[model samples]
Target: MAHLLSVNAGRGRPADYTDAALTGIDKRPVAGPVAVAAPGGPTGTAGSGVAGDVIGDLRDHGGDDQAVYAYAREDLDLWQAELGRELSNGVFGENLTTSGLDVNGALIGERWRIGADLVLEVTSARIPCRTFAGWLAERGWVRRFTQVARPGAYLRVIEPGRIEAGDRVEVVLRPEHDVTVEVLFRALTTQAELLPRTLAAGEALNVLSAERIRRRLERMNGVPS
Candidate 1:
């Protein structure tokens, strides 16, 4: 069954890999229930939606649009095999480590009911960063991850509540759009030409994604962005 395999939260720690001088990318699984709520305001001001979870880079990470990050265990296993390393739940800095779910295949604006009350809407795909590459200490990690185009889904909290490991996840709704998380990731990274089609997802796309698509379309139309 599709369920949360683990709930991970991180604390700020010094890291030379990031310009912020600190990072919360080393998320570790925790026992018991964790609070989930929307961190209102801009990304720079708002923090992670999961209580006890830290967002070290407020300038580029966290916010309502990325309140929660979910990665499937299946994908992690794939990476584990390729990298020849053990990747535990939350190793990718994901808040929720999911099992038996195709997180990358989820459509933009898809709604998932996790546990009993917490509802999260898929917003966008995670764009790998310098911190992520550094965290893994893998050469050409960013490029490799982008090429795979299996970036996990970022979500917006719709209903605030407590959640814990082993909670079942149910798909409540899916928007009528072809813009899946993987497609969105590819459009934003490797395939800029696909950006125009991503607009079909409408406002469901995160602010950063929508703006990027808009700029790309404008540039294509010979308009100065």
Candidate 2:
């Protein structure tokens, strides 16, 4: 059974220091089986509960999905190859580290029931940001990350519940379209032309991504700048 290898959380002003400090946050045991809920549901309050909603709150602040991260079981080695020297705590800043799951391939609007308490839906991929570049101390780390691991994903809770380490995570739903996290990531960052097409496909993209695609279509059609 696929389970959460670990779970992490933190709160801080966005900046270079924040990324460095996230290294020390402690990971604890999730009670077991958490539930995910829709945005604005009782369990989805931005400041309350297990910080999933808190991340959603940050999104409200205009923070893009880059503020969060998810990593696949297989790519853990790749991350180590890139940033192993900087990872003294032996954990990445990702809020969730999962095993036996390929999150990048999960469809948007798809639901993942973690353990029994928490439910997470694949909403979007975490686009690399300058903060990540600062963490890597590389000028092009953001582009490099996009080109390399394609990372894991960003999620929103569909139900609220306690999530701790070692909880089992299973896919409750998958997207009907073939668009994957890697596809979306590539479309959004490297291949600008595909943005509209990927958006048109609209199989697994989160709300923000969908909006971005719509905007691209508008621009391509010369409706507005």
Candidate 3:
């Protein structure tokens, strides 16, 4: 049974990049009821487009689609075996941490509703970038992440609502398409054979990140990369 394992949010004071170069920001648990938006809906302070747009941009910047951040449930042992180190208490920067969710295996376009308020659409998986690499305080943390756990999905809010720790999350839709987050991640990063299918799924989501993937796939096939 899938369960909400833990919920975390950035509590570290917003980094004043101009004032000082902050190497890493710490994440802590937060009260629930996070924000969400719809297509052509109001985008929050992040200044993208809609809520999905925000998620799409984040994906471009290396964030996962639904499982934006994740922490293992079997204590720190899983992290040690997978991440090569124990997750320090309150370390993994994730908005909602869950258990029993094979988030990586979750099909793209799946939806999960939380607490009757927030509706999350599984979009894609975490693609490590410089920010994540810096977060781990290692030069090759991104490569290590890809080689190790493969992390989870990043979610776009389908409806606006408050989410809190301990809220029950129910899967609303399981994708019928073969495209999964892992497949999309590989399509975007490694030039997989299923890249065309992954791009088609991304286009169905109508996300800019997906458009980028589609373009990349086209180029890779000698149609245009």
Candidate 4:
């Protein structure tokens, strides 16, 4: 059975490893329950996004589109074997580290019910950026991660409620689309040609993904974005 392994939250703080900006990437597992919900602000405050999860860079990082991020423990274990390092929960900056669930293979627009009432919809896959590369402190991390292309899924809060560690996770609803998060990662990172095919997922994609597909369409037809 799929279950929530941890509920992580962080605050904005200086990170020498990353660029000259405060980051909330060093998330730690919460001791008790934490609320999971959509943002109360237009862009979203630190606590408003998910009660305790902080968003340092709103312009590029946080918003309603990426309210929650989940990474599967199974996949983390695979990375652990490859990297020869013990990766703990929240080490990858994932909000909810899950077990047994196929986070990468999950279809976009899939609704997952956590705890009693917290519902999150799969929106997109987490993109590995400079911040992530720096936080990992690994050379060629972006390329290595992009090549591996198992980037976890980002979720949008659909129903607000409290959640905690060890909570059972259920797939409440799945859209009738075959486009999974892994497919999205491949299309966005490795294969530009697959971007146009993502239109099959329709509105399941977030604004950035939708725009990327549109630009791909334009480029294919020799039109300006």
Question: Which candidate number maximizes lDDT?
Answer: 1
Runs in model 2 deviating more than 4 A are: 13-49, 52-69, 83-92, 200-204
The C-alpha lDDT values of all candidates are 0.93, 0.57, 0.56, 0.83
lDDT of 2 by residue, 94-183 (tens): 667777888777766667887666766666766765455554576577777878746567776666676666878888887676667777
Off by over 4 Å in 1: none
Over the stretch 107-172, how does candidate 4's per-residue lDDT look in tens digits? 989999999999998988888987888888878989998999889998888899899999999999
Ranking by lDDT: 1, 4, 2, 3
Model 2, position 126: C-alpha lDDT score: 67
Better of 3 and 4 by TM-score: 4
Single out the weakest 10-residue window by summed lDDT for candidate 1. Answer: 208-217
- In model 3, the runs with Cα more than 4 Å from the true position are 11-25, 32-77, 82-84, 88-90, 200-208, 223-225
Q: Pairing residues by index, what is the TM-score of model 3? A: 0.73
C-alpha RMSD of each candidate structure in angstroms: 0.9, 4.9, 5.1, 1.8
For model 1, give the RMSD to the true fold: 0.9
Colliding pairs, model 1: none
- Model 3, range 1-225, lDDT digits (tens) per residue? 666655554432434331323322355555544544433322222322112222222324322233344444553356556557667533645556676676777778888876767777776666676655556676576666666545566676567676556778788898668877777776666655766677446433535456667677677678944
Ordered list by TM-score, greatest first: 1, 4, 2, 3
